[model samples]
Target chain A: MSDKLISLLSGIIFGIGLVISGMTNPEKVLSFLSISHSWSAEYKWDYSLIFVMGGAIITAAPFFYFLKNKEVSSLGLKISLPAKQDIDKKLVIGASLFGVGWGLVGFCPGPAISAIAVFDPIVLVFLVSMAVGVLVKQNIIK
Target chain B: MTDFTPYSALVGGIIIGLSVVFYFFTTGRLAGISGIFENAITNSVNRFSNLFFLLGLVVGPLLYYNVIAPKVSIAFNITDSYTLIILGGLLVGFGTRLGGGCTSGHGICGIGRLSTSSIIATVIFVTTGMLTVTILQQFGIYL
Candidate 1:
């Protein structure tokens, strides 16, 4: 089909996956990341993220590997993967910053976006702030 | 109340993996959320597709909540102060772009591709997030 339709389908699947995996639930995320909290909890740690990521990686990894080997995907289109693979200062620093944000809010972008359907006002604030942050990066920081 | 859902999460994860596979085979593009958001902001050639993808993220969950799992509300709560929430969003947004990808791009898609940078980024970020929580807990900080 069309590129937009394909992406939309992909996004829909991802959204449902986040909800089914409980990644859309802030409390689930908080517990997963809460080192001390997990120690006190009955479950030890919410390994849902591990399960989810493992599921995704196992199913997707081999497929992508084979696709990357080819100059083009099954659709006869060239695969576009990020070329930069260096572990530079920006990589570490930026990821650290993201981690801090994640730890603070119990959200990364995907979950944040999925949580939007919950109809919480706080989510709106977070979304606006995220957009602003991107704006700052493009306009002021760079 | 919340409970562990290891099996459901794994099921969801397989769907995620399949989605990535579909995106790759059909569109020939990595299904990175942050990259799509970035494209939307930068007015890239595929910005409209990015919008479509993101909109689907919202619509899909809405349909599931309303139709599939009405009993599962997945209560929304973050004890962090409003200031922290806003600040956290900004940091996540800027950081993901600067670092090249967020959890999905770097954590899942990046690692799947075996990109060294994604592997390193994933390790560093996850460790840092855990450390941040650990340190804050020690400091009697709630956020």
Candidate 2:
């Protein structure tokens, strides 16, 4: 298969996983984030996020470890991983902003993209805004 | 909890992990959505493949809802307010770019590789996310 095809397949499978895991649902995500609500009698905190992350981590860790020392992948493509090891200010500030947004709307990039299939107006708005945000960061916020 | 779906969540997570592995094996690239999206937009290298991957993200859920599980309707019960949605989107987009990766990138693939930066990113994001929810709740802002 061509590289593009492989990428397409990988994305499809990833999207399916997101949908199946209920990550595409903003309400579900918010429920998981709202841990304080677990004690509330009216609302129940969702634990699916924990299970989903745990399952993915467990399944992918071995492969990552195995490939740690390899220069190339099974298909002969040169492997490329992030090499940055330092925990810098940019990382901390950026993550904090992302977290606040996620908690506020329960929409992250992956799920936001997946939610496009739903044909909701709000999703479109959010996506367009997200694109603008990216553009701003890349071009203006250097 | 009334909305728990442990079995499906685990199954879905495993599928996600496998997808990341498959991507790495075939393309020798991490399946980090934000990175892919960012590169697809700003950089020309592997732009087509990145776009295809993003296209697949949309198509995957489309196929699932329309064919594989027609009974499961896609729903977003969260707030329909455009102001909040746009704000959240901007933050997520800017933050992911500035920070390096989002949930899939930092939470799954990053941690999977045991990257220290990724681990710290994940902890910060998750903790802040929970704190955001708590703060919002205190103000009666149920999103």
Candidate 3:
């Protein structure tokens, strides 16, 4: 199929996965992050997040390993994996900040995108702010 | 205690993995949602594909909710405060861009490829995320 079509299909599948995995649910995500809650009888820490990651890793790791050296994909496009390998301050600081945001609302990029279908007013606000944040990083912050 | 859905989580995750693999196979690119979204706005090359992907992402859940399973309700319990939501969005947007990837890129696709930077990024974000939650709960500020 065409590249655009393929991309569209992949995104749909990914979105469905996010919904099924409960990643779209902020409460469930918060529960997963609140590991300490597991110790309290009144609260139960959800292990669904771990299982989701584990499932994705197990399913994708072998494929990636095999394709590591491949220069071209099945569609004859050049394989474009990330080239940067350094664990620098940018990565650390940025990730820390992202984590804080995620913990605050339990909305990451993937889940946030998927949650758009819910038509929640908060989702629209978050998305617009997120876009502005990206612009700030690319233009002002840099 | 009542919200655990391990089986569905695993199944959904595997499906996500497959989508990542499929995207790679077709476009020879990693299916990083942040990167895709960023490029869709700023970059020109492959912008159409990125847009299409995002369109599909939105459509996916709609289709599921409207057709696949109409009875299933989506549980979304986030804070009603618009201020917190907006702040969280800004942080996530800026952080993901500055860091070069988000959960899909660094956590799943990156880790699967065994990239060192991705692994470190994932570790930091996940740990920090947990810490943030823990600290917030300590303050009795559960969102």
Candidate 4:
């Protein structure tokens, strides 16, 4: 129960951050991606997401470094770091596909959930489709 | 509307960082949203925890919406029809799992930890995303 509650709170913070940072808005994300164009208008180059992401990494990195030294977490949960260290085809292909999708819609999983916070037919469609996609991938791999 | 709110963005990010840090310290796991979502659906991870975490994501906005009902806005419509949205969703779904993480996983937690694979993955995704947008613009076409 404690674990569930903590993760729930964590999700809350994350969602709040996403919304406040404008990442949940497809338009803002679209502008950020538009930066790929050299002639994009100055206002169209939205780097606010960068500030949000950078702030997050800056604040979290030191604690993560501290966590690296310990076996159990500060709260006594077992350390669950990923064991996989390989860079293989799946990683590249999957990431590449994700990038394309994101450029197309600016709705990667995290912000897609953030998009849902506002309620839209399109966001729901994306969620259901993405879920189905994950299921498809799982079945194929196994 | 096109203006960027740097202060709010930065502060909100710090709050998010704090939450993720707490998540790691308490759960001993990185807060990779997509990974958790995938694991929950597949029954590959602690389904209850992941479910509740995702549930919290919904509840958080609901709570905030009580105070501020922000109108949803879109700057660029990627496509005129639902086809693009559907296609984007399919690719995201397959690619995130295939790639092993998403923005939150590889972009935030993975890069923070200095994981070589995460960094490489991030670079690839960002590059592809840039190329996708650039190419579409060049061709005056969008999918």
Clashing pairs in 2: none
Residue A55 C-alpha lDDT in model 1: 94
Winner on TM-score between 1 and 3 is 3
Model 2 chain A scores worst on lDDT over the 10 consecutive residues at A37-46
lDDT for residue B13 in candidate 3, whole number 0-100? 92
Tell me how each candidate scores on DockQ against the true complex: 0.71, 0.78, 0.80, 0.66
RMSD of 3: 1.3
Global lDDT of model 2: 0.88
Candidate 1 regions exceeding 4 Å error are: A37-43, A74-76, A140-142, B139-143
TM-score of each: 0.93, 0.96, 0.96, 0.91
Clashes of each: 0, 0, 0, 0
* RMSD per model, one decimal: 2.0, 1.4, 1.3, 2.6
Candidate of highest DockQ: 3
Residue B135, candidate 1: alpha-carbon lDDT: 75
What shift in Å separates residue B13 of candidate 1 from its native position after superposition?
Answer: 1.2
- Candidate 4 residue-wise lDDT, B1-143, digit = tens: 24667887798788778878989988898898889989878884678889888887777666666655446343233344587788888889989998999888888888888889999998898889878877877887543
Lowest-sum lDDT 10-residue window in model 2 chain B: B73-82
Runs of candidate 2 with Cα error greater than 4 angstroms are none
Clash pairs detected, candidate 3: none
